[model samples]
Target: MTLRYHAHKPLRHHPGMPETRLAALLSDVIRRQRQLHELNQRRLAELAGVSQATVARIERGDRSPSLPALERLLAAMDLQLTIGVEELDAHLDARLTEQAARPLAEVLDGLGLDRIVDRLGDLPYLLTGSTAALLQGAPLPTDAVEIAVRWRDSARLTEWLNAAYAQRWNARWGEYGGVHIEPEEPGEHRWLTRHGELRAQMCDELPAGIKVRHGDRSYRVVPLVQVEATDPRAADLLRRHRQRQQAAEAPAG
Candidate 1:
């Protein structure tokens, strides 16, 4: 009863989408689960240990699920939501191609100093560590893939990122490596709007000697060249995503 596209569906999809849009996709799945379960807000509220208002908000796609809240609701239905690497990449591709694609400059005129991720068609190596913080939405986009962009995509990009923060998707710079970034706080929206168009740089491909600094620490956006050597599945997943992204690329922008 999850959100799924039937085989005969006509909608076309792109490869990996930006991180923010994926939150909407996930929220849609939860809403569908509620519908298929034939459970109303009141019923879900009782079974999931949430109030009617809470259930209503989640189903309306106005809110994202916290881990514990998701657990409680899943438990209520004897179901669990599992996100594998495949599903994650698939969702990313769909999102990237959904909205109109802007040029690199239009995507980055306002964000901070940064570089584009190479390997265009599919972004296989997600900057899954401290590297993510160097970007706008992913001050820590690890475990989440990073899409290298130019100044062109900045406004829409930031708008998209602000949406992610609103949903509590973690994008903050984590204290240390291996510590996942999570937007678990209430004021995360404030954190997102704080960057009032920081200047950044971007080349069509990865460049050497590019650098970015936040506080006393510096981060870089180097190609994830080694991931392909180690994980073959990662390569395949990204290839599929790239195909989808290119296909979804709108002609206007």
Candidate 2:
């Protein structure tokens, strides 16, 4: 399911951006965005609409990319960076929350469905950008669930996309904001996010939403123990979950 972040309202920018500072920030942002997208030097270079060597140059802050050019790169990777602002932290979680309140599939399916990655499968996904947000429970724009997967053979992506998991998706209909129905289609896998740059990992177990039904008509989710939290994608959620736990343990203030 896709989650909306309190960013990009009218896509405004913060003021007082010196050319030098803007260049530095853009360089850092490009580097981070590429890393989060988990694009390797070559792959990220292609997707960012820049050359691989240029990507390296940009990342090192040696080159100052134009704002429009940078915007294209960011949009391609599904990252919305905030800059030159008096209130960098100011955001409207309310809009995102409202958007998230709607059923994911309902809106996502209508928003031009794209290739989805099923982490439960045998493929390898390059973790980055919005995919990173989903894994970490960081706020994100309401979009389809996305992860870059490494198909053994590029052709294998299509095979997997059409192939359904033996098990049914036992999720509560509309429970999750967006859906990543497994057994993806490879032909549709047009873009491969650079893998491992962000150091994204597999979940030690299944996610909470994953479930199954027994012959006896009983239902179950992928158990917490079976759920692998090692996936860096869940970093934000894990941190938030930890904070909530800590708050609960704190003495009454």
lDDT (CA) per prediction: 0.41, 0.42
Error of 1 at 48 (Å): 0.7
TM-score of each: 0.30, 0.33
Please write out the lDDT profile of model 1 over residues 173-216, one tens digit for every residue. Answer: 21111222222222222222232211122224333323445445
Show the lowest summed lDDT stretch of 10 residues, model 2: 192-201
- Candidate 2 per-residue lDDT, tens place, 162-209, comes to 342212121222011123423342112222221211111123332334
After aligning candidate 1 to the native by TM-score, how far in Å is the CA of 250 from where it should be?
Answer: 20
- What are the runs in model 1 whose C-alpha is more than 4 Å off? 1-20, 86-89, 92-253
Query: How does model 2 score by TM-score?
Result: 0.33
